[model samples]
Target: MKVDRGLLEKINFDKGNGLVPVVVQDVETRDVLMVAYANREAVEKTVETGYAHYFSRSRNELWMKGKTSGYIQKVKKILIDCDEDTLLYLVEQTGVACHTGNWSCFYRTLAEGDGNEIL
Candidate 1:
């Protein structure tokens, strides 16, 4: 879907910190890959290019994922929550979603039979 300016504005970008949370998921498998942040420019860039881009709060600049690490995420679809403060990205991922090299940022799972520690 082509996001018009008015629609984009309705997404309620968090300009207070100049960033918005972007949740990336694997569209086909429904596995969540990673979570990142995006500024207006990064959001626009992602829409314009069909790839994921993020605004680095640490670096204070725009950065494209997989540019240096080769873990690029290809955009499949984008959805906004009803409140429009957060975004969900259905994507095709190429490599580990976590910088720690985990398949997903959320690596730990609830142990099926054991309640002591998460898997």
Candidate 2:
């Protein structure tokens, strides 16, 4: 079956670059784990394998999550933002999500009010 490109038309790539932002979150715990990018091949790879894959703009190559570290992010549900420019992946993550040994990529705490601050 052919995948629909129309479904992902709202994603914003960087300056003609092929990458789009993808946010990974824990499906059960509702905690954001990390953020990555999906190029056309990466998106197709993720859909086909049910695992998260991303195109690293910095490294200029495709990278599968947790390939070496074994901290894989399995896709549970993927949600696109209203603008279609961003992706929210409700995933089943194994072990740590970040390479830094943290549960989430968003690990820093900034000065903000009690429960509403996101970091």
Candidate 3:
């Protein structure tokens, strides 16, 4: 769907950090791919181009997922949370979602006894 600037503007971007958390999900597999943050411009670009774009807090800049690794995420649908402060990005992932080369960023799990372990 086209990115509607009007809809974007209606979101509560006024929250702390002025960014909304976006949950990326695999459309076909129903698996969560990753979680990232997106600023207004990032959201706009994602909707505008049908690609996943995020704000890199570390670099303080906008970045497209897989931009360097060529692991682009094709957006299928975007859903807003009830509070309008978060987003869900249903996408068709092309390659690894984690920089570690895993299919998803949530490849690790934390158990009560075991420390962080591979999932």
In TM-score terms, which candidate is top?
3
lDDT, candidate 3, residue 34?
92
| Candidate 3 lDDT score at position 79 | 89
- The alpha-carbon deviation from the true structure for residue 46 of candidate 2, after best TM-score superposition, in angstroms, is 0.2
lDDT of each: 0.87, 0.83, 0.89
- Model 1 — TM-score against the truth? 0.85
Best-matching candidate per lDDT: 3
Candidate 3 local lDDT, residue 10 = 78
**How close is every model to the real structure, measured as TM-score?**
0.85, 0.84, 0.87
- Which residue pairs collide, candidate 1? none
Number of backbone collisions per candidate: 0, 1, 0
The residue-by-residue lDDT of candidate 3 on 1-119, one tens digit each, is 66656667777774668888999999999899899999999998898899999999899999999889999999999988888888999999998898889999988887454656665
The TM-score of predicted model 2 comes to: 0.84
CA RMSD, predictions in order:
3.5, 3.3, 4.5
lDDT tens digits, residues 8-112, model 2?
A: 555666658866789888999999898888887888788888889999878999999989999898897777788777888889999999888989988998755
Residue 109 CA displacement from its true place in model 1, Å: 4.0
